[model samples]
Target: MTNITLQYLTQEQVDQFYRDGYLRLPHFLSPDETEALLTRARQLLSDFSVEDHPLTKFTTGDDNHVGDDYFLTSGDKIRYFLEEEAIDKDGKLTRPKEKAVNKIGHGLHELDPAYRKVTLENPAIKGVARDLRFHHDPVALQSMVICKQQHIGGEVPEHNDSTFLYTDPPSALGFWIPLEKCTAENGALSFLPGSHLTAPITKRFVRLPQGGTGFEELIPPGQAPAHPEGKYTLEACEPGDLVLIHGSVLHKSEKNRSPATRFAYTFHMIESAPHAVYDAKNWLQPTPALPFSRVLDDGPNASVHPAAGRV
Candidate 1:
C-alpha cells in the first residue's frame, strides 16, 4: 500500500463544499493508485461467472428499483449487478458478462484489499472526514465500483444519496473517485448546487416488512420541499480526482453512448453517533460478523473476510 499523509481540506475548499453541496479535489489519488483499482475491478469482472448467477439489474428510477435477495443482502458481501440494457426481452444477457456488469458493490471497502487501502487505511480520507466535522466516528458503507459500460450504459435519474442510505438526522456523505477520465459523452456526474440545504429527505429506500424492498415516506404527503430545476453542473474529472458529494445533493449521470467506458469507485459515510440513528429498515444493514467500518481508527482487526459462499 502506498503511504499517504493526512491531507486536510483548506478552509476555502470546506467553505465551497458547504456553499455548493459538492467539492472536486484534483489528483486526490496518484495515477498508480487509480490504475491499481481499475485493474482490480477489470479482473473481478473477468472472473465473475454467469453460469448460475442471477442477472440482477441495478436501477435508480422511481419505479423498477432493485429489490431482490441478491441486492438486499449484499450489504456485507461483494456482489455484481448488471446494467438494465444488458438484458434482452427474453431475460437473457445481450452481451458478455464482463461487458454487461453495471457495478460491484456493498462490501469492497472491507473485503477487497485495494479498496480497503484507499478507504480505510488511507489517512487522507480520514482527514477529509475530520475536516468536514464528522466527529461522530462516521461509519463507511455501500462501497461500489460503477462501470458505466460503453454503448449500453443506462442513465441514472436525479436522486439524493440520503434516500438510499438514510440516517435519523440524515448525515450521509459520498466519496466518488473515477478510475478513468470522465466526460459528458461517457457519463460524467452532474450536480444541482446547494440542493442539500433545501431538499428534504422525504422518502427512504428500505427493506419491506414482508420481504423485498420499497420506499417509505419520511414526511407527510405534500409536505416535502420543491427541488430546483435546470441548474445542474457537470463535473468532468480525471482518474485521480475525488468528488465529495453531500448526502442530500441532487445528482445524476447520463448514459455512456461513447465508445469509452467510465469506471468509478464510490462509497457513503454516515454519522454513527448516538444522536444520528441508523434505521434498521434501511436497505443496507451491517451484520454482526461484518460491522460497518469506521473511517478513523483502522486497527489490526479492521480487515475481515466474509464467510463461505457470501462473496
Candidate 2:
C-alpha cells in the first residue's frame, strides 16, 4: 500500500505571492476536478439556454453582463452578478430573488469553505458592451475559472483591477483557474509581476469597436487599454493549476487567436487586514469566505463580531 499526504501551500509560495503580487500553484485542482468543473460549467450554461432566454441577449461574452439581463441594487454590481446566476427570470431581478441575493451579497463573506464564483465569456466580460471596467476587491481574496475560452479577437486586454471594491493596496486577490489547458497561444492571463506594490493608478478609457455604445475596452467602460511599465509574465499553465494574484497586480490577456474559445470563472476575496493597501475603516465586519485563506490577528476579544464595536 502507498500513502500520500495532501500538500498545502509552502512559505516560499506565500512569500512569492506577496513579493510578486501573484503566484502560480500547479495542481491546485486535480486534473479530474478541473474536468468535472468544466462539465458543470457547460451544464449551467445549457440550463440558461434551455429557458430560451439565455442570461444575456447575445451568445458568448457579448451577450451577458448587459442591463435587462439581470437586476441589481443601486450600487451593488456584485449582487447583480449573483442574481443573474441564481434567479430564474431575466428582467429586473425581483424582490423575492433580490432578498435571497442580498443574503449572498451581504453574508457571503462569512460563508466558510465558500466555492461561490462567477463565470464570464471573456468576450462579454472583457468587452466594451459589458461594464467590466478595472477594479479591485476591498476585502481580501477572490478567484476566476474558465468555463469557455474565446477563439475570436476578444482577449482580456491589459489593465489593473481597481473599479470593483474599494480598498488600499488591494488586500483582495484574484484566482485564475483553467478548466482547459491555458497556453500562451490561447490568450492566457499576462501579468505585470510586481506592479501591485505601488498605488493603483486611475484607469483611462479605450476606444470601442464598431456599433459602439462607447463601452469599456481596458479597465473602464469607454476607454483604451493601459500599458504597465514593468516586467510581464504570461503564464503557461495546465488545466489543474490555479493562478493566485494580488488585487493590485496588473494583468491582461490578448485576443484568443486559437480555434478554441476560452471559458472560466473569476472571484475576488476580501481580507480583514492590510497587505500593501491600507484602509481599515471600510472593512466589512468580516467575510468568512473570502477567495483565499488568510491569516487572522488574535486578540482578547477576537471572537466578537468586528462590527459590534468590540475592540
Highest lDDT scorer = 1
lDDT of 2 by residue, 17-102 (tens): 66676777787666665676666555444333223332332111332322332322111222222222334454542333212121
- For model 1, residues 24-69, the per-residue Cα lDDT tens digits are 9999999999999999999999988888788899987776789999
Name the runs in model 1 displaced over 4 angstroms. 1-7, 298-311
lDDT values, one for every candidate: 0.85, 0.42
Instruction: Give Cα distance to truth, residue 178, candidate 1, Å.
Output: 0.5
The lowest-lDDT stretch of 10 consecutive residues in candidate 1 is: 302-311
Worst 10 residues of 2 by lDDT: 124-133
| CA error at residue 60 for candidate 2, angstroms | 14
